[model samples]
Target: MSENITLTVNGEPREVEQGTTGTDLFGGDKAVLVMRIDGELRDLFREIPDGASVEPVTAQDPEGLAVLRHSAAHVLAQAVQQINPSAKLGIGPPVTDGFYYDFDVAEAFTPDDLKKLEKAMQRIVNEGQTFNRRVITDAEGLEELAHEPYKCELIGLKGNAANAAEGAEAEVGGGELTIYDNVRRDGTVAWGDLCRGPHVPSTKVLGNAFKLMRSAAAYWRGSEKNPQLQRIYGTAWPTKDELKAYLERLAEAEKRDHRKLGAELDLFSFPENIGPGLPVFHPKGGIIKREMEDYVRRRHIEEGFSYVGTPHIAKEDLFYTSGHLPYYADGMFPPLDVDGQNYRLKAMNCPMHNEIFRSRGRSYRELPLRFFEFGTVYRDEKSGVLSGLTRVRMITQDDSHSYVTPEQAPGEIKHLLDFILGLLRDFGMNDFYLELSTRDVDGDKKDKFIGTDEQWDIATKVLSDVALESGLELVPDPGGAAFYGPKISVQARDAIGRTWQMSTIQYDFNQPARFGLEYQAADGSRQQPVMVHSAKFGSIERFLGVLVEHYAGAFPAWLAPVQVLAVPVAEEYYDYLQDVAMKLREAGVRVEVDMSDDRFPKKIRNASKSKAPFILIAGEEDRDNGAVSFRFRDGSQKNGVPVADAIAEITRVITERQNTDPTAG
Candidate 1:
């Protein structure tokens, strides 16, 4: 008689035969792509351990989706090998919304090649080939992957995968070496790769809901010094409808890309003369930026924050004191030697803000002291990573710091969270979730962080508690905290459903001690104040980029660079429109008048292209009637409105700072 093993299946105790596998429990459910036993993802064919907790991972789950994508990547690799037998493989990992596989091939993949690869992958997906995992020793792996140099290198760097390359984890991230083989119905090996995988049971599980997006050149292990391989990008979904929807969202996102919109709207540009990641805002973009700055500054003051200023450069020792020099040196530019002193461009404002806090002694009455600034900082961002405004070297942060006693930490964090959310909502970003980034106490790089374990635990709990109480979806990000302490980052979804990390509030107990910042308590005892770092707009440039994409470059009336553009019915009505524009200008509207040689229709078209919230059109009838016609951004028109009413309506929208469409009924 076979012995029965006790297992906790989905929180319920169950008895199964000793040799029972996950397939025995969940094979009937096609949605169950993989299983998690003892909190680690495993193949369905793997036997369940006695007394272990088990849960089915379906295609709809995040981990299940990653497994599906990884399986699709394997199919893609198989298809590539079928096409070009000489192609060597690199690591294939599932990333956000997709997976990518690197290949060392003779030539760069072209559009036609991608099409061919897709067809091949579909055939492989239809073949119903089973994925079989086998454990192997280092020598065995080296021998089996002798033809693939990258795989051998990964095997050699098994424990230290981080030093190898970016996606190397997918290949050698496990405790032991293993290879996944694509086996045919007859039990013959079709293809194989060195991997640490919990792939879908079979290639057929991928179905036709996978696509080969494109191919690009990527360095091996993400190092420029290494050989460049052609990386094929792809996405996988549980259903065809989901795949279609994802593609549609991608199309819409491309249309709303900030870089493209910035160029077409004449908002901002990255001039080659100024170098990469440095953007110059045009007059239109400047207007939006100035408005943002003014509004945020006013809100900070209203929220009991004192506006402060800091220099662009500081001595190197200050960063060392702040513990940013060694940990954050990669993101900072090289230091400048000024009269035998090393002066470095500031990558953050917290160290300088710490100086201000330590500049004076404080009492417990000023418990939650807050300081805010619009500090422009520079980073040494890699050229490859630089995007239009979102990933720039020059970042203007609405940075703030709150100094409070340990007892006031939670409340202060709650206040900062509320302020951050409110500011985001005011800017038309209402959809949000929170992420709690905590220290990696068990990680290999634990020395990189500073603080006692007790301090870290208290700080993390304070942030986590506040985030959970806010009733928003909170995601845990272990090993993603700053060197000093944990943080709560606000991830906001834009119009197209793409999430961006907008604002953050970090709880730091180490910095105050490092800076020797103290406040006198009521008991006449001095205590180190806890520093909470908050950035309402993580960076002005990045926030503007997000807003540009969020609004699709058609900003609301209040944010529109040219709030009102006056177009003449003809060159004769130019004076009538100019008079109306002057009235609007006097009313504090950013108004412009079309007094060019262009035809009336051309002028109206130009106004429409400008994305002006309101357009005032004057003709002979309007000039004689002491009225002007209103043309809105949606192409709707209201004719014969009194000049006074037009000015009042526009002023009202701007004064109220309405973010909705002004023309909406």
Candidate 2:
């Protein structure tokens, strides 16, 4: 007879057989794909222990979704190996929104091959294959996976955590080695993978809600030194409807892909000769950039920020003082040896700004001194991470640093937060939330962060209180703080509901002391003033990229590169349209006459394709009546308006920063 034991399940005490498996305990509930035993996720096939807290994890839970995607990745790898027995597996890891499995194969996978693999995966999913987990010795793992060199190498690194690579987390970790066997219904193992897994009970739970997205070349373990492997990317959802929704979002994201829109709109380009992650803004893009700079420059002046200029490169020791070297060396360009001194392209502007604050400073009255600059900086971004303007090596930051007494730090942070929010709202992005990044006090990781315990505590509380007082939802991001201090980053959602980290407000106590900055206090004692760093438009190039995607390349009237396009209805009306264009230009509107020899309809088509906010059309009737027709971006027209009214309307739309078509209103 089997013995019984009491277990705390879902906050309820229950009696079950001593050797009850998770599947049997949960009675094979389809929704309960996995179970949490005492806080640790375990395979359903693993027997539950007596007197343990148990909770069912459904496919909708975040952890369960990861397991689902990871299990699906295993199915995909099994299908690939079945089709090509020579193919060897490297690693399969669950990533954001999906998972990807790397395989060392002789031939690159094509689109047709992906369809074949999908069918094979579907067959495996229908097989109801049970995933059996087995604990094995490291030597056994190595011998079993001897044919797969990558797996064997990972097995050798079984207990070493520091040397583990990105995808290695899915295959190796913990004190023990384990492998997951895909057992067929006939009680025979169909395939197996060396993994640290708590997979779903059966493959059939994957249902038909998974898809193979695409394939790309990826280095094994994300290291450029390793051999390149073909990586198959895929996504899995709990239901078909959810899958369809995710696919729709993907389609929308593809439509808003900034790189494609940038070229089509003639905004920017990344030339091969210039090097990766470096972009050249065309004339049209330049206009938008200039407008942003002009607006911010004027605003900074109003906000009592003294404009300052810094060089593009600085000596290496300055960064060591700011605590960036060694820790942040990989992200910085290699230093240049100049006259026995090492100079590096500036990767951050704070250190130089700190120098400016310490150049010559005194008195309490100058306590809240603020300096702003459109400083250009560069980072040694890897080629794989570069994506047009969004991830560029060269960046121009609207960087500002403020020095204030400890008592005044709170007020300064509030002012900066308001400035950032207003600036984002002006740019047509109003949805926002604040994320407070605090230092990780956890073991080992804590050493990566600097600053005394009191300093960190004070700075974290100040940012947290300020963010909370603003009534914006504040999310905690532990281990996300900069080396020197804590920060609050504004995450703004755009037109398509995608969040972009826009501005940052960081409080630094370490740098101020490191630089030995001091100011005379009102009590007649020298003290270190708190240094706060703020970047309104985190990086101008990246901001432009976000805006391009936010508006899908059809910018607001005020932000549109060419605010007005004047097209004549015929050759005879060209001179009349030029007269109207002159009036618009006088009204401070960016207007140009389309004098091309193309026919009127084609001219209109060209203007529409340009995505100009306003199009002015002139014809014989308009010339006779001293009027012109207004064509808005939505293909709507308000015809036969006097030239004066047309000019005033266009000027109003542009000046008011209208995001919608004027005619729509």
Candidate with maximal lDDT: 1
lDDT of 1 by residue, 273-390 (tens): 9899999999999999999999999999999899999999999999999999899999999999999999999999999999998898899999799999999999999989998899
Residues 1-665, candidate 2: write the lDDT tens digits: 99999999999999999998888878568898889999998887788998999999998799999999999999999999999999999889888889999999999999999999999999999999989888999889888989999999898887774476776878888667899999999999999999999898889888999999999998876778999999999999999889999999889988889899999989999999999999999999999999999999999999999999999999999899888997789999999999999999999999998888888867889979999999999999988889889899999999999999999999999999999999999898989999999888974568778778998999999999999999999999998999889999999998878899989999999888988999999898999999999999999999999999898888988988998899988889989988888888888889889999999899999998998888888888999999998887778888899999888877877878766555442
- The C-alpha TM-scores of every prediction are 0.96, 0.96
When summed lDDT is taken over every stretch of 10 residues in candidate 2, the lowest stretch is: 656-665
Residue 25, model 1, lDDT: 94
TM-score quality measure for candidate 2: 0.96
For each of the candidates, the C-alpha root-mean-square deviation to the true structure, in angstroms, is 2.0, 1.8
lDDT at 409, model 2 = 99
